[model samples]
Target: MKLLFVADPLASFKIAKDTTFAMMREAQQRGHALAVCTPQGLSWQQGLRVQARVQDIALTGQADDWFSAQPERLAALADFDAVLMRKDPPFDSEYFYATHLLEQAEREGARVFNRPRALRDHPEKLAVMEFPQLIGPTLVTRSSADIRAFHAQHQDIILKPLDGMGGMGIFRVKADGLNLGSIIETLNRDGAQSVMVQKFLPEIAQGDKRVLIIGGQAVPYCLARIPQGNEVRGNLAAGGLGVAQPLSARDQEIANAIGPVLQQRGLLLAGVDVIGGCVTEINVTSPTCFQEITQQTGCNVASLFADALEAAVRGA
Candidate 1:
């Protein structure tokens, strides 16, 4: 099968922990043709089917110089057996536009995983609202009053921008309410933008578990990203220490309950951020930690992902 991965630049990839690279490697081991392109490479000319400036890539077993690419050429997305959208987020206007173009390609009978329409509908931070029973007390608002009200009731709360990634723009307000007003103003842009506020779960000390679900099934292990000293964010990008472990009963329960729904929604792969057994985010776009789980737990996440991709392509 020819698999085209839409993601960040190959030159900048860290093979040690890059999930996309892991997927590519596993697929290559299985003798699948692998190609790559960035979101900028995607194009939709007037009557042409959505296409990309794609490069066929070969994975060399090297540390720094891992992948060597063929010269770029234009190809319709439908030409690939499967198109994996593995672009990391700030899910900004450019990413939004890329999804629309991918959606157009899907209309031309391109097999895109984690379907384009589902990607647009499920913004990582906001997607958790769909499963209130699985998440903690949450509120989305643009008004300072609304945030203050939520803080007053919860006492401890977390505030973050809707489009933030890598734990950026996240603020925790304690019972003392220090800098509460400033945080609200900065996050909401003085009521011009909306922000997500949730009751701070004290179980963050244990770690924020990233439970991966592939093809409507849960991976038995999870990477628990534990926050470093004086840090409230448990994201590895935010300097957290990742410790992979088997899924707890509660984690499995949450995965079992939510996995099938996401699969039905066309999100073949997903990562659910759970702290204290309460879901915080539903990561549909480029959910990661494949290498971390593999290194720590001996679970070959990329292999499982490749298997799912093959099955999906066969079914399609």
Candidate 2:
């Protein structure tokens, strides 16, 4: 089988800790040919959809080193058996363009994980607003007055870029906090990007959980990320450490409620974040954490994820 992975770059991959690399390894072990591309690589040539040059990939011990696949322009999506849209995000215009291109792949009979059409229909964070009862005090706004309105209701709030990934551009602002103006300005200076302001959960001083819902079933476990000193954000990218943990009734309930929703959205694998038993966010685009959990808990997360993904794509 030929598979193309649309991702950030070719050479800078941490195989031991990257979910995409892990999945790639699993696919390779199963004897599949692989191609790698980036968002900038996608282009439409007449009726043929082509991607920038792709190299072979293999896990390597050396940092920023990957065994390169023979570089070549990728053919139309119909020529490949599957495509994994594993690019990281800030959800910029380029990312949206890639989704449109991938949708073309979906039309030509290439199976795309999580379904390209659904991706276009769903922006990970906003999609979950449909289930408000499960989440925290989330306010999506570009107006300072609206943010202040939410701030009046909650003394402490978590501020994050609405279109970011891996916990980037996350900040915690307490009541009458310092420089709310500066913070909002910093987030919007690039343009008028809406930010998501959520009620800060003091419970995060303990941890936040990243739960992976696969094919409508919660993995038997999820990761609880303990924040570092003086940090309110529990995102792994923000220096939080992941520990193996079991699901509480609260956790199970959250997963059970969300799993079917994810399935119906055609998001076969999703990472849902929770703090203090309240669903904080839903991460659909390239959600990761399986590597950390598997290492800590001795679970075959790679195999489990791969099996489920292949099953979803193959209908087997």
Candidate 3:
């Protein structure tokens, strides 16, 4: 299979931990041809199909200089057997526009994992609202009064922006509501943006678990990212310690309930964030932790992903 990964620059990847790098390595080992491009390389004109300026690459199996690339060339997205969208996000305007371009590529017979439309529909933070039964008390609003009221009810709450990734702009307000008004201003931009507020889950001390679902099935193990000292965010990017462990009963339950639905919506892969058994985020743009889970649990998450991707491409 000829796979084109629409991702960040190869130079930016920490191959040891990057999920996209893991997938590329697995695919390369399996003899699948590999190419890569950033979303910035995506282009479409009135008469031409959606195309990307892609560079064909070969993994060198070395630590420092891991990949060798040929000169870049423009190719229609449909020319590849599969196009993996592995871009990280704040889901800003450019990201939103990129999805539309990918959706156009889909119409032109491109096979895109975690379908472009699905990515647009499932904003990580907002996607959890679809399954209220699986999540804790959560509120989405731009109004300061509504946030204040929710804080009054929950006493301890977490405030975050809808488009934030890697635990950015997240804040916790206790019963005393320290900096509550300031946080609201920062997160909501004074009614210019919406904020997601959820009741604080103390089980976060146990870790924020990332349960990966591939091909509508739950991976047996999850990466529990435990918050370091004085940190409320348990994101690996936020200095959390990642511990791979078997999924708990509640974790499986949540995965079971959400996986099929997400798959049906065209999400070939998803990372469901569970804190204290409550679904907090449904990461579709680029769900990760493949290396962490695989290293500790010997689960080979990238192989599972390769299996699913091969099946998808063949079936497509």
Candidate 4:
């Protein structure tokens, strides 16, 4: 099968930890022809179909020189058997426009995983609100007063911007409300942008577990990213140490409840973040940890994803 990955620049990938690179490696090993295009390379003229300046890539085993790419050439997205939207997030206006292009490509018979509309519909932080039963006390608001009230009620809380990734712009306020006002100003931009406020889960010291779900099924192992000294965020990007462990019973329960819903929404791949027993976030855009989990647990995540992608393409 011919596969196209709409992702970040090949030159920018940290091959050692890049989940997209792992997926590409597995797909290549299975003899699938692979093409890659950055979001910027996608274009659509008024009368023409969506096309990308895609490079066909060959993976080298070397970590430093991971891939060799052929010269890029324009091709319609529909030319590929499946297109993986694996771009990392800030999910800004440009990302929104790119999704619109992919949605158009979908109409022209290009199979897109985690459907474009679904990606737009389920912003990572906001998506967890859909399953309130699984989450801790949470509030999405822009008003400083509202945040203050939530802080008063919850005592210890986490405040973060809705669009943040890699734990950027996250703030924790204890019962004393240290810098709460400033954090609200920073995160909400003084009532212009909505921010998420949740009651702090003390269990974060254990780890913030990332459970990967593929094709409506949960991978048995999860990557538990443990926050290091003096850090409250357990995101690997936030300097946390990742350890792979078998999913606990609560993890399985949460995955079982959310997996099928995600599948129905066309999110073929997802990462559900859990801290303690509370569901914290649902990561659909570029959910990672493939290398961390596989290396620690021997779980072959990339191979599983490739298998799922192949099945999805054939069925599509």
Model 3 lDDT per residue over 1-316, tens place: 9999999899999988999999999999999999999999999999999999999999999999999999999999999999999999878899999999999999999999879999999989898888999999999998999999999999999999887889989999999999999999888887999999999999999999999999999999999999999999999999999999999999999988998998888899999999998999999988999999988989999999999999989998
Show where candidate 1 strays beyond 4 Å.
none
lDDT of 1 at 275: 100
lDDT string for model 2 (1-316, tens) is: 7778888785576676788887887788878788888877777777565554566565443555556556565566667777788888776788888888888767667788767777777787787697798987788888887877887889788788777776778888888877787888887663477888899888887688988988878887889998998877778888898886887788899999989978886888888888898888777778888888888888877788778777876882
Extract clashing residue pairs from model 1.
none
> Which clashing pairs does model 2 show?
55-69, 56-68, 56-69
- Each candidate: what lDDT? 0.94, 0.78, 0.94, 0.93
Lowest summed lDDT window (length 10), candidate 1: 307-316
Residues 1-316, model 1: lDDT tens digits:
9999999998888888999989999999999999999999999989899999999989999897788889999999999999999999989999999999999999999999989999999999988888999999999999899999999999999999999998999999999999999888898987999999999999999999999999999999999999999999999999999999999999999999999999988899999999999999999999999999999878899999888888888888
Error of 4 at 60 (Å): 1.7
Residue-pair clashes per candidate, as listed? 0, 3, 0, 0
Q: List TM-scores for all candidates, in order.
A: 0.98, 0.91, 0.98, 0.99
Sliding window of 10 residues with minimal summed lDDT for model 4: 307-316
Instruction: Kindly report the root-mean-square deviation of model 1 from the true structure over all alpha carbons.
Output: 0.8
Error (Å) of candidate 1 at residue 206 is: 0.2
| Top candidate (lDDT) | 3
